[model samples]
Target chain A: MIRFDQVSKRYASGNDALSQISFELQQGEMAFLTGRSGAGKSTLLRLITRMESPSQGQVIVAGRNLNRLTRRQVAWHRRQIGVVFQDHQLLFDRDVFENVALPLKVSGYSKSHTERRVRAALDKVGLLGKEKMRPGALSGGEQQRVGIARAVVHRPAILLADEPTGNLDPLLSRDIFGLFEEFNQVGVCVLIASHDLGLVASRRRRIITLEQGRLIENREQRADVGPG
Target chain B: MSARDRKTASERSRTLPQHSGGGLLSAHLEVLGDSLRRFAAAPLSSAMTIFVIAIALLLPALLGLVADNLAGLGGNFQDSARITLFLTGQTDDGEAVALSEDLRSAADVASVSYTSRSQALAEFQAGSGLGGIVTELGDNPLPASLSVTPSNREPDAVQALVTRLQALPQVESVLVDLLWIQRLDAMQAVVNQLGRILALVLGLAVLFIVGNSIRTGIEQRQREIEVVRLVGGTAGYIARPFLYSGLLLGLFGATLACLLLMALQLAVSGPIDNLLSLYGAEFRIRFFTAVDALSLLAIGSLLGWSGAAISSLTRIYASPP
Candidate 1:
């Protein structure tokens, strides 16, 4: 579960990234955060991951206040929430398997357990066969899949993505969305930040919109669009 | 939510277990292996750094060895100090022999040898290269002397013994041959002091070398470190490989330095022994012992670990996570 109560973040450069933001997502729920560029969507996701503390009010994840966590506790907190970046952030020097196994390795899993989990996660993203190939040798969509596999490899309670499909084709973007839906159906809370209004609207799920650091809209559609 | 769904959700909330004791050991081994691979990846630079460390360590080790050998030579000089007493001209050979016998029983005197006037004259004639002039003289001018070796060779102690000998009625004068021994001891002290200063300076040099080397390594792996931190890696985990790198560098450097010292000792031992033989001194050069080698290794590794720790703590861990 993730909750934000009257959260406002002001940068050191005197710019308001988010102001008076209040929202809550229950357990096993999925939502899309849609906004134009510089609309504080990325900042909101960072707050959830404890990468940046809110300037005012509270941002809570898994019943723990982000502001109260110490420096050492921050790492443990981040481990419970999976994060995917638009750039994939995979190490180019290592193969696909190593990139996907990074989270599991950080969690101190045994070698055999890590191998099994990495393979299973890679299988879900359709990257199981490319385990030995380096990220530099992969296509844009495949690399994004590797990043997705790495994020969910540890089976985190919550998943956050910031423009994960920004560089992908429409078909590949749908495939990435489908992977998030699959994780969400299995009791995993997922919140995605994206600007593609058309793709986001087609999902028939709850949508939260941000404009100039203010929440302008929170809407839900009831019609089931089924798996895409 | 259904009970099965709630069970799965609770399970997902629980993260993997922390590393066990065996797991921690394996993790260290993994880091060590990673460090070794890194060295293998950049052999030239690693070898160069190690060579610099070796040369730095070798200087202090060699200086210590020299000081030890000089101290040994000084001990020999102290042991050879003796006092010679000249008897009055009226004292005959029998009186001189009797005086030598009496002095031999003294506690301070280790041994005493009597040289009659004729024996002293013969020795002077043979050593001074004035045989023909000495033979033409009808009467010998050399005085009978008693050479007394003292058990205690301290300057003050030798001086006291000389004073006691000069008080004898038949003794005209007393000569203490300990000034050269005292001068040798003073030179040994100076050499030992120099060695200590050099060791301090060079030890600091080694620390700086290892620190700078590890700093460069951190810079080259900056991106890797950033990614590790982003993925919930602890500070200790991120710094482990670098520490191992510093440790290996220092350990290998010390090993090389030890080898260099042994080679130096072997190369010079032959010539040094021959030179000592020419001086009629039975002294052989001794190389570093096992204890010395072990100490060098320990110092090298300790310096390396400290250098890496300081570099990583100040550079990477100083910033917020």
Candidate 2:
């Protein structure tokens, strides 16, 4: 669970990225954060992960105040919340299996467990058969899926994706979104930030839209859940 | 796949997240191995780094050998280096014996003995094969003399004895075998001081070489490190491998230096031993002892570790997850 109460973030460069934002996300919930470029969508996610602190007000995730946790605790907190970057952040030199197994390895998983989980994560991404391939050898969609596999390889409690489908075709985008929906149905919270208004227009889920560092809309999408 | 049988391995791993990175032993070895592998993958960098460290370590080791030999250069044949005190020409037998005894009791004297004129004549006659002829002539023209052999140690003590014997009323002359041993001692001291300074300078050079290598390694793996941190690896986790690499490089460099020095010793050992034998002396060259060898290894490893630690400071601090 994440709660942002009157959270305001101002950069040192004298720009207000987020202004007095108040929001809460419950367990097993799937939500979309929509905003134009520079509207603080990533800033919100950064606060949730405590990558950066709020300028004012409280930002609490999973019960601990974002400001209260030590750097070490913040790192541990990050372990439970898997983050998928827009660029997929894969190390090119290493093979796919190692890339996905990285989080598990770092969290000190046993070899057997790491191997099993890394393969499973790859299977979920439909790339189990390509475990040894390098990122450079994979297609854009496959690479992104590898990134997804890496994110969830530890079976984190939540998945925070920033424009995960930003570069994918419609079919792959649908499949990726379906993947998120599947994980959410299995009790993993999903918070996706994107500027693709048309893509989220049909999804029957909560959409929080921000404009000029302030949330303008926080409503459940009642219009449609189109094209599976 | 059916949900019942489709459980992800990631879930299985998540069931126990604290046992995967291997225990501390494997953890350390894995890091060391990775570093070695990375270095091996780049033959040029590995060779260059090893060469620099080897040269740094060898300079000190060779100079230490030189210093050791210099200190022992003249001390090897100590007794042959002292002055001998001879009794006066006109001294009577009784007077020569008494004077020899008195000199023997002197603080600087190691030993003294009176040689009667008759005994001196006999020794000369026998050596010159004029024994029967000299025996016929009889009364012996040789003067009674004392052979005084002072202690081979303490240059100042021997010098003081030379002055005291010359001042003796009954004594005739004094001879110091190798008066320049005092100069040898002074030269050894200077060489030792130079060795220490040279070693210090070379140590800094090695540190810089290793530090620069580690810095390049950090730059090369910047993205990999970023990805590691993103997945929950701490700075310590990331630093462990580089530190191990540095230690290994240092140890290898020391080994290289020692091996080279050993080869040099073997190559010149025959000539060096022959030269000493020509002087009718036993002066065998000593290789490094076990303690000295271990010290070399430890010093090299420490230098490497320091370099890597210093380099890691900048890399870890600057990296962003």
Candidate 3:
């Protein structure tokens, strides 16, 4: 579950990134956040992860107010949420297995448990066989999949992806969304931020659109439309 | 795999693994091993850092040895200093012998040997090559003298003893031949002070070298660090490997420095031996003991840890995740 009550974010450069924004998503809900380039989508996601605190109002995720969490608590709180980025953010110097196992390693999972979990996550993303290969050797779609495996390896309750398929082709984008759909079907909360309105509108899921640091639209797709 | 396996795998992955007490310890050990692997991966860079640190550490150790040898040389000069007590012209050989016995029993006097007036005249004549002239002159002109060596070579203690002996009856004069001792003591004091200053300067230099190395390491791994932070790695977890890398570099540098010092000591030992023989002195050069070497290693490790910790922790917190 995620909630933003009258939340506002202003950068030190005197630029407002978000202003009095308010929203909530129930547990296990799948949604997409759409906005223009300078809109507050990234800021909103960062607030949820406590990467950057809201300038004004409270941002709560999974029943905990992020404002009150200590530095140590922030790290622990981050463990409950999985985040994917546009750049794939994988350490190329290490192998795919190492990249995926990072979250499990940080959590102090037993070596056997880490191996099992890593294999499971990689297998879910169809990257199990490429564990020994460096991420540098992977295609763009494969790199994104590896990033997805790393995020979900620890079994986080909430998954936040920031423009995850920004660099992918239209077909690859659909495949990536399909992976998110599979995870959502298994009851993981998925929230994605993107500027691809055409693809976003075609998917027929929940959409919250932001414009100029303010929420301008909130709509859920009709069930009759189904998956496109 | 099949959906059945997927169902169970998701179920198992849903629950977070329970951590035993040993888990944290193992994680720390893993991080340490990871740092060693990193060092192995960049052998040339690691060796360069270690070499710089070794040279920085070596200067101080060599200075310490120089100070030790200088003190030893001063001790030798102090040991040879003696106070000569010349008896009055009227004192006979038997009286001079009795005075020497009394001087030997004194608390500050280490040894006392008497030279009768006739013996002193004979030694002076032989050295001056004026034996025939002295024989024509008749009666011996030199007075009986007692050579007094003090048990304590300290300047103040020797001066105190000299004053005490000069006040005695039947003594014409007390001559203390220790100007060279005074100059040597002053020189040794200066050398000791310089050694301490050099150690402090070189110690700081080592710290900076280690810190710079760690800074570069952090820069190279900046993206890795950012990824770790995003994935819920604590600051301590992120810093563990860098700290270990610093410590390892410092320790290796210390070991190399010790090796360098030993090689230098061996190379100069022969020359030192020849010089000692030329001076007819029994002084031998002493190398650092095991304790000293161990202490140097400890110091190097501590310096490395401090530099790494300062750089790593500050940079980790200063930058945004």
Q: Report the number of the highest-TM-score candidate.
A: 3
Error of 2 at B162 (Å): 5.3
lDDT of 1 by residue, A53-105 (tens): 88999997777788998777878777777889899889997899988888777
**lDDT tens readout by residue for model 2, B1-321:** 235123322433343447533544565676777788898899887988898899899998888988898767767756556555566667787787778778778766778766787788878887999888878876676667667777647777777767877898876777676458778888888889989998999999888888888888888887887777666676777887788878888998998988888888889888988887897776656666777778999999999998888888667766443
Tens digits of per-residue lDDT, candidate 3, A98-208, equal 999998787778878888989999999998899999999999999999999999989888889999999999999998988898888877889999999878887888999
Candidate 2 lDDT over A99-199, as tens digits, reads: 89888767776677778888889999899999999999999999999999998988887799999989998889888888999999987879999887877
Scored by TM against the true chain B, the candidates give 0.82, 0.82, 0.81
| Pairs that collide, model 1 | none
Q: Fnat of the models, one by one?
A: 0.43, 0.43, 0.44
Q: Residue pairs in steric clash, candidate 3?
A: none
Model 1: lDDT of residue A59: 94
* lDDT at residue A218 of model 3 (Cα atoms): 85
By DockQ rank, best first, the candidates go 1, 2, 3
C-alpha positional error of residue A76 in candidate 3 after TM-score superposition, expressed in Å: 1.7
What lDDT is reached at residue B182 by model 2? 79
lDDT of residue B198 for candidate 1: 87
